[model samples]
Target chain A: MGKTYALTGNPNSGKTTIFNELTGATQYVGNWSGVTVEKKEGTIKNSDIQVVDLPGIYSMSSNSLDEVIALNYITKDKPDGIINVVSASNLQRNLYLTLQLLEMKVPVTLILNMMDEVKRRKINIDHLKLAQILSLRIIPTGADDRKELKNIKDTLTLDEVSNFNRFSYFSEDVQKAINELAQKLRETEHRLENDIHWLALKILEHDREIIERIKIINLGAVELGYKLRDEIQKQTKMELPEILAKQRYDYLREISEQVIEDLDKSLVTETVTDKIDKVLTHRILAIPLFLTIMLMVYYVTITGLGDKTIAFMEWLVGDVITKTVIAGLNTVGASEMVVSLVVDGIIGGVGAVVVFVPQIMILFFFIAILEDSGYMARIAFVMDKIFKKFGLSGKSVIPMLVGSGCSVPGIMATRTLENERDRKLTIILTPFISCGAKLPVYLLFAAAFFPSNSHIIVFSLYLLGILVAILSGVILSKLRYRGEDSDFILELPPYRIPRLKNVAIRMWDKAKDFLSKAGTVIFAASVILWFAQSFDFSFSRVVEPSDSMLASFGKLIAPVFSPLGFGDWITSVAFITGFAAKEIVISTLSVLHGVSEGALVTSLQNIYSPLSAYSFMAFILLASPCFAAISVMKRELNSWRETGFAVLYQTSVAYLISMLIYQVGSLII
Target chain B: MTIVDLKPGQSGQILELNLSTKIKNKLLELGLTPGASVMFVRTAPLGDPINIKVRGFNLGIRREIAQGITLK
Candidate 1:
């Protein structure tokens, strides 16, 4: 059987980066915490070993949910070995976790990652001496450096030769208390033999999770632990956990003083961040600079260069595939129904949504660049004050920005928020941001109605989504999910050139997901929609879609939306199937209307006025997200009632806003 | 004085952490203990969340949390 190893480290310590390097995995590596909330497993390349990358954690103390996850998995799974990845640039703080892992007596190999950063600071770490001091294997590696892979593999696969030993950090009095507590724990109803010393220390430190985990109900042991903590407090003049943490740091500092040479203090004076922040985060220039950058991105993708590329793809799928498939079917003596289903229902329907692949890929590519380059965190930093006025934090911007690429990951990104109220509030508002799935709908309508000003029109729609989100956040904060605003304790990682391979990997993953969905869910939805539109309730063939079962269902809901204009059954069909996935709205229209790409835009013009079409698009933008997102909301919020509330709140807001826009727009135009 | 009172480019030693237990523990884990020297870097635009260099890394903390950190 392959040995299993747990990869653990502090957030932003390059743990996941090393994991990707070792396993050839393309896991998303953000320069922020909570990027990996759960354990991700992959096999090391060319080795019979499996590595599980745990979420970045500060320590085993379980202060946060991610910490609790990593702590629990490491202790319970009892992996064959643990690879503790540490950032060499931040050794003192990172090694606090290393000491705690050593106390657990697990076989560990320490990877001193980002050694190049340390070297750049002119710090010379005596790795041999440091390893000897700790009595464990240590590998000093840099970003993209796999030279130490052999050493890591050997250390992990080595048979136990009795080199492991547990270390102690507390003073003599605290040690006595731990021993007595361990003795008392052995006599209690619940006792953990192997971890008695660690448990005793945890109890002294008042770790609530650990106290509850082993079910130690000994009142005397607790009293002893408290007495010892009081004595330590008198001696150290600090809280128990802080006192212990300081001891670990003191130990690390001593080791560093001996082994590290000539660490340049001048590195602090040469910060590039100061110069960059002066312009990027300037008070008067920040927001406009952000807007200009975003507009430039949208212009290139939506109206400028992206449109031409998409037009070519459209010709390939809409004209080339449709005509060739129909001709082949005709020559093969297939029935007219088979020909229509194959040509119009299957190819044209899925192909309509597939034509926007270039634009979606471009959008995702830019987002991944922002994420990997560490600018997304700064965006949150600059936007926090404005968001605070809306009862949110600047941290909420990360989810909204990510949600633009897609809402599912956008909603999932809320895990990083420290408070439940902020997380739930962010989740509720994230769908309002037009995700990439909604971009196709915007592109379709914007190109047809406001061809000359498509860029401004689309940008306005995106701004409208943010406006609606802020308004809804204000209302919701006042009514429900109100609480003290959490602190914006975020780290601003230094900006680096985004790694090209990582960017390409992220783009490829997103494109593959979009295509697979087109082949499966969108394809199936199209076939079912075609059957409903082409046959009557009696299953008899019908020439007119209005004579079929779909129109009967559409008519029932069409009247409900007449107040916003475009109250036709065909439009109703698109809106109904859109709940499955937002892009399906365009697909359903193409299949049901039997119009190819550009012609569908003209066909839509005959159905509604430009003002009404804009209103319809607004409604689609603001309505509840696709079913996948709603269920993800249900899972994340973990309450059916709250999920239902989100859906109702979003749909109601969409209806009222669309009605207001359409009614006011009609009066002006 | 608290950390919030420090101007950019000024350095101060943490004298006490007057935060809640949970927040204090996190701060300690981040190497912001009493006696560790912390330097005020710069404020973000609008001057709410300020950056500080502690233990060889930059960390941004909000004004409210900074007010809770007594410094000398």
Candidate 2:
């Protein structure tokens, strides 16, 4: 059996980097908070020891969700040992969390990371003395270095374990008070006798949640906790929690002064981050620079190497594979209906969306680079000044940015928001940011309607999405979510060169997810839609598609959308199928019109004028997200009523916007 | 004066904390205790969230919360 250990640390302390190096797992590592909301486990390479990467936390106070998660895992799962990863670059703050872990009495090995950065600042740590003082084995290693991984593995292999002398951080009077409370706690029916010290400390601090838990153990524990809290407050002339925190800080400072040495000018040099931020976060240049970078990403994906790769896939799936499959079926005496179903319906429908995978991959690649290199935090920081004016928290920037890739995880990311109003407002406005699933719809229309200026048109669509989101956020915040704005506390991590391997892993993961969806949901939806389009109400095959069941159903809803200008049964059916998944909009059109890969624009031109086509694209861009995203929204919001409201609002807004654009464009054109 | 009053490239010692219990606890957890020397780094481009260096790390916080930190 493999021994299990939990790896824990402060946010951006290089915990995930060490986990990746030790386990060879390609987990996503970003340079900000809320990156790892869930605990992930992997087996160590060449050993049976399993390492669990707990979410980064500041302390074991259990105030936030991430801290609660880490604390609960330590107390409940009770891993065999803990690898306490601390940052050498910021030892004072990082050591506070390490001390808390030590107070839990869990066996811990300290891994001092970012030693390279520390050294560059002319700071030196006496690791031997520090380890002796803390009574733990300490190893200094850079996050990207592999040499110390073997040392960690070897340390985990040790069999003998002994309790170290517990350091008392509190004053003698406070210790006396804790001892009395601890003794009372032990005499009661409390099941936490083993953690009496921790319980007594929590009681003194009046940690509300901990007090409640202690009440279950023994009602007397609650009364005793209140008494201790009042007594501590009187004695210290400060809040109980603050008093305890200050004591720990004093202890940490004492150890830090003895064990760490820094040159006189360690804090005075113009660091690399300072030089870079002066320009990147400049007052006059930040917004325009951000826009230019985003424009370049879209331009390259649509017109550069991404386009070339997509063109090759188009030939392989649309022409070569389709032709060969139909010929083989004909030689084997397959019926014409079977050939049509296999070649035109199944292959043609799914192939049209599959060929665009290269472009999607390229887009995600750039997004991954931005996130990994720490620029995503800067974007949030820069946009917060604008987001605040609209009554949304700056934290909303994270969910919207993630929403660009997909809405499920994006909606889930709202867990980081402390205010309920901010979380809900963010959830409602998140889907307004054009997700990758909506890309195919925009590209299809851009190619058909705006050929030479496709890049700019698509870029404008993105800007329009942002505009709609801001307007809706403002309206909603005024009507329902009005209050004092939630505070934004963010960390701007030093930017690093994005690791190529990490970027490739992220891009591949996203592309593989898209391709897998194309094979499964898109394939099944295409076949079912083809059947519905091919059969009439009498259950007989129809010569004209207008006489089929799908057409009859589309005719029912087509008039409802006639005001938006694309009211044909075919386009209506495409919109209906699109609710299942966004990419199905393109596939449904190909199946309904019998158009192959390259002939879609010409076929669409017969049904829609360029002005109406743009309107249709606008509708698709703003409409309700796919069913999967809605289900996730329901789960995250935990309210069907709110989910229903979101979908209704989205579709209504899409309709109004599309109608306005089409009506005005028709007159002008 | 409060942290929000500090200009760019200035430093001060935190003298008092007068915020809600929740925000105060979070700041303490991040090593922003009273008497810690804090330097005002720079505001973001649009000048709402201000950066400060304390305990050898930079923290970016909005002006609303920064107003809670009284400094000398």
Candidate 3:
């Protein structure tokens, strides 16, 4: 039987590129159990070892679902041998989790990844010495280079190697506690081998899960823990865990001093990153830089390159693809019902989602650049103060920025936030940002209604989203959880020139997600929608009857939206279908209004006045997110009550905003 | 001086923590007991969670928590 090892690290730690090199074409990527976050697993080429790529996490402290999931899997499943991946350049911070894992007594092999980056920064490490001190097998692998990876694969047989010299600096009190805990363990029937001292120390520090485990073995362990903690405190006059941690850090510092040789010339890169930070992370300049970047992204994805691609795709689908299918159906003498189902239902519905793939790709392309270049972290860092005032962490800025591309990932990104209240608030407010999927819908309306000022209108819509998100966050914070604010601590990695290969792969991955949805869910949805629209449930002879099944159902709900100025059956149906996915709003409109290729703008103009169009855009912008987003919120928030509240709040806000826009705009016009 | 008074890049050993009950509990949970040597990392430009080295890891604590922490 082949053994499996997993490579895990924080985001931007070069994990993916390493995986790509190791596995190449032998990889299979799928979603983690019951979640949309991608799970990557692959067999190591020519080797018996299989590697699973878990999602990136900053810590395994159970602060977020990602952390919880990562920690639980490692502890419960217990991989054959865990590969602890860390950034070579950021060893000081990375060693924190490494120490935590060592304390867990997992057989860990440390891979100091991104050695090239460390070399570029002119930092030298004595790998053998450091490995001996850390009591683990250390491999310095440069992910960007494939030759180093091959070497790692060839040398994977070394196991049971323990370097005892790792503990260089243990406080006297901690050493005493460890001794006591080890003695207590020896008294039990079960052999407490393999770092029992470390486990006992963790228990004394009140690691919740460890405490629970110890309770199951012996309730008296808790008493022992209390005694040891008190003794340590009395002797050292310090908290047990803190004293232990300080000892570890001091050991790490001492080890780093002997192992790492920092060259003075490395100051150049630091200066460059700092100089860029002056403008990009500047208190006053940051917002403008962010806004400019966002605008460029939107412009490129919507009206610029993305719009051109979408236009071509629209023509291909509406003209060549659909028409060809119709012609083939006609020649085959296919039944009208079958023809309608295949052509109008399946083709139209799925085509709606398909058309937006280009835009999604472009949007993710920009996102990849921002993320890879390390600019996204700065965006979060700069926005932390502003978001904190609204009771959100700096981490909230990630979801908000991603929200502009797609609310699903944006909401999913909220898992980075440690506080439950703040996470929920960030999730609730994320939809206010105009996602890329909603861009076509916005373009359709703005071009129809506010043609000359479409740029300004588009810009204002985004601004409006930010304003609404902030206002809601503030109001909710005041009304709900008001206390000492949660602090935001983020590692600001030095900016580097983004790798084009990595950026392109990330963009392709995101675009692939959009295309896959179009083929599966959106295609099926369009077919179902077409069937509902074309066939009457009760055999009606007249196809255009007012009492037809689709018409009656649409009419039943149309009046609810009357005050918002788009109460027609077609508009109501578009809104309903939009709940499946935001991009469906445009496609539903295209189908219902009988607009073929190059006629979406004109058809939109015919269906709605400028005032109504603007109002409709506002409603969609504020409405309940798609099912995927809701599911993610449920998973991340871990409560249907919170998810239900989010839906209700978003829907209510959308209705009010749309009504206000329509009523006031109509009065003015 | 308190940790709040320490400049970036300064190093100190924790002497005392005078946090509010809630914050104190949170800190205790995070294992920030006194006598832990803390090295000041960079602060956020707006200065909320002054980055500090603890337990061989970098931790960001709010100014309110920093105010409570006495350092040498």
Candidate 4:
């Protein structure tokens, strides 16, 4: 059997960069068995040594989702070895995770990354001495060097029978308690296959996951465990976690004193990071700088270059593909029904959603740069104060920003939020942001009704989307998700130049995901929509769509929207087709009205006044996201019931707000 | 004094964490132990969640979490 090695490290330790380099084209990404934490695993290039890239974690304490995923994979899967990545610049704190990996009895090869930064800061680390002290192979590597990359691959294949006997960092009293409990645990069904001492320490530290697991597997062990825990805390005058962490740091401090020069002195005395942060995260300049950056991002993605790319994609998919396919079908003597199905149902429906790819890509491109350069963390740092007021964390800003371009990737980005409630809340709130597709709907209505102040009306609709999201966040935090601690403790990683390759790779992944969804959910929706619009009650193809089954269905649902004032069958059909894609709302109306997009404004002018038009725009802004977004919601929420709840919440909120806008305006105006 | 009690640029040694066991375990793991010195870097723009330097790294810790950590 090929040897399996688990790649583990502290977050922001360049673990991902190392994994990408080592695996190259051999890696594939998938969701972990139960959770949304992404699992990346692959064979080392040119070798059969399998590497499972466990989620980046500070410590294997199972205190966080990442920690639990790493701990479970290591303990249950029982990988042969661990490739623990530690940044050299922050050696002591990074080594904290390294020590935890050692205690698991897995032989760990330490990759001391960012050696150049250490050298630049004039902080000297005796890698040879450090390796000897810990009894692990340490490869100190700089970012620019490829020499150590090969060194890492070579060490992974080696049989590491490491004697990490220095792993015993606990005091005598704590060690005695652990030894007693570990011995007792061996006899119970709580017999961990390996590292029972580590398990003992965890239970003593009040690791709820392990302790709860022990309670079911070995009930009698709980009594002894609690008794020992109480004794240790009383004897040591320290909580178990405190004791464990303190002892580990003490040992790390000791090792650093001997192996690292001037370990007590601050290694970073106003480094480049601090210098940049002074302006970027300054007391007065920070928020303004952040706002300017966000504006630039929005301008580039939504209104500027991003808009041109999107228009190009629309032209490519709409006119080019549609015309080419029609000519091909005509030459083949295909029937009119087949031509309509392929052109209108297939190209028009799926193409409508696919056209947003450029905007999504451009948005993700900037997002990737922010993430890769580490500025994204500072964004959360700057925005946390305001976002916390609404029961959301600062990290929620990224999803909303991404949601403005498209909600699919926006919902996916919620995976970064570690708290379950925060992730769910962000997912529920994100679709309320006016995505680019919804913008066309707003502009069309705005132009048709309030021709002069269309820009302001469109802008108000955008603000309304944000206002509704914030209000919903407040409501949900109180009622749906209360008592769950929305804790925010984010590490501010040192900024680095964003790698173009990494940014491109991120865009590629998002693009691939979007295209796949367009092919599946949106593809199916269009075919069904075509059947609805094409056939009559007896399944006879009709010349006019108003005479077909869709009109009857739209007429039935039209009155349900009467309170919002756009209850006509034409508006109803547009919204129905909009379930597939929002941009299709304009096309559906244009098709049903027998006019092109330019004349669509004059056509809808009589149907809606300024107030009802604004109300109609309000409904589309906050209503249920398109079918493609719903599929993404299903995947991200990982449950149909929660996705259903999210859809219901969005649509109901949309209905109430639209009704309020229309009713209150009619009364006041 | 808790971490929130410290002004910007003020430094203190961690006395104890009064948070729940789970949160305390997390803070401890992040190197806010009894003896570790913490430097309150600055508060965020809207003045609630503060940035602090601990163990040679910066953490954007929520004000609520900071209020639970006793500093000396």
Query: Which scores higher on lDDT, 1 or 2?
Result: 1
TM-scores for chain A over all candidates: 0.91, 0.91, 0.92, 0.90
Q: What is the alpha-carbon lDDT of model 2 when measured against the actual structure? A: 0.80
> Candidate 3: misplaced stretches above 4 Å?
A10-12, A25-38, A57-60, A161-168, A182-198, A262-271, A540-542, A545-547, B2-70
Ranking by lDDT: 4, 1, 2, 3
Chain B TM-scores across candidates: 0.95, 0.93, 0.82, 0.92
Q: Write the residue-wise lDDT of candidate 3 on B1-72 in tens digits.
A: 888677766667777677554455345434455665666655666755565655333455566667788886
Best candidate according to TM-score: 1
Candidate 3: tens digits of C-alpha lDDT, residues A212-242: 7667676676779888898778877766655
Docking quality tier of candidate 3? acceptable
Model 1: per-residue Cα lDDT over B1-72, one tens digit each: 998888888888888889888778888888888777788887887877888888767787888889999987
In CAPRI terms, model 4 is classed as: medium
In every candidate, how many clashes are there?
1, 0, 0, 0
Cα lDDT of model 4 by residue, A342-374, tens digit: 877777667766777777778789888887888
lDDT of 2 by residue, A393-455 (tens): 777888887788777668877877766677888888888898877887887788888889888
Which pairs clash in the backbone of model 3? none
DockQ of 1: 0.69
Quickly count the clashes in candidate 4. Answer: 0
Our tally of clashes for model 3 stands at 0
